[model samples]
Target: MSNSQITAVTELDRSHYKTKVYSGGHFIYADEPTDVGGTDEGMPPAALLLASLGSCTAITIRMYADRKNYNLDSIKIDLAICKEEEMNKDTTITRKIEFTGDLTEDERQRLFVIADKCPIHKMLSNPIKIVTS
Candidate 1:
């Protein structure tokens, strides 16, 4: 098993809903929108989630293509989260992937399969346990 840690800190005096997030040696800010009593200084939580998944999917596809020597030029991923209370169902995430370069249909299909193999995708697709102290 592999473990990684990230820390998020929020100071009310600094902003109502802005948080400082530290992961590895990287730092970023997360905040809600201004209408939600935030200063809109950074991406909201849902946007961050989509960003992670999209990036992971792209990287996973790129790595596989490169390893196989496929003519993959670039990858673009679009992701969105949707929740419907009217249907009384769980939240759904939609991901659209676009690949550029000369590739056969078989290779493209296989790449689609590889996208789901990304760590973030697998983690989100399975049941997760969050233990807090």
Candidate 2:
């Protein structure tokens, strides 16, 4: 099986913890210093994951509309993630997609289906194997 991977390296310095996250050979800085009560200024890992999902959902819908030649004016996605109980064994994410412009009932329904089929949504819904060295 083929797999994709991202690497995140973090270093703790005098001011805050600095991190460099890499995906597809591209790197981005993610740091948060202790002064602001964040363990630095970068987003916590969970927040990053949420952002990915939100972005993927919105983009996927936009792509679908454009491909289908639908007159979609705007697409907005709102997402919230909640951990299950104290154990954190399970997490629930709720997504709300709002579409603007003229759309038929069929087009709207199809968009909802397409949104669920986004890459990030599939990743979150399917079982995942994580290896830590």
Candidate 3:
């Protein structure tokens, strides 16, 4: 498998009433004064998820623009996730992607469609089999 496809494991340490999480070959601690016991120094998992989507969207747009030879100065994507009362009965994730740059109408629409084709977006939208022992 490719390096990006490799599985990773995290080990947590909780001795003397202190919590620490080790993952990606590094150690992370909960944020101080928050008491959530997450990476105090690093971003929480949920934040990381949102960030991943945003970053992927931006990078995907950039790649598409570069491939098309579009004179794109920059690409910014604002992502937000919210739960809808009726649709989120079982807890669903809803994301909003906003693109900002100098592009024609067609390019703008095409890029939006391309954003949905991102690797991470595909993985999240599709179902996967998880095995645990």
Highest lDDT model number: 1
| TM-score for candidate 1, residues paired by index | 0.86
Report residue 129 deviation for candidate 2 (angstroms).
1.1
The lDDT-based order of candidates, best leading, equals 1, 2, 3
- Expressed as tens digits, the lDDT of each residue in 36-99 for candidate 3 is 4443565555556677787877788788889998767777666555522454435445566555
lDDT at 87 for candidate 3? 41
Per-model TM values vs. the true structure: 0.86, 0.76, 0.69
Give the per-residue lDDT of model 1 (tens digit) for 1-133: 1375545554445567988877656788888889879989989888998999999899899889999999999999999886334322366789999999999999999999999999999988988899979
Error of 3 at 123 (Å): 1.0
Clashing pairs for predicted structure model 3, backbone only: 29-40, 30-38, 30-40, 31-40
Q: Please report how far candidate 3 places residue 57 from its true position, in Å.
A: 1.9
RMSD of 2: 3.7
Clashing pairs in 1: none
What overall lDDT, based on C-alpha atoms, would model 3 receive against the true structure?
0.65
Model 1: worst 10 consecutive residues (lDDT sum): 82-91
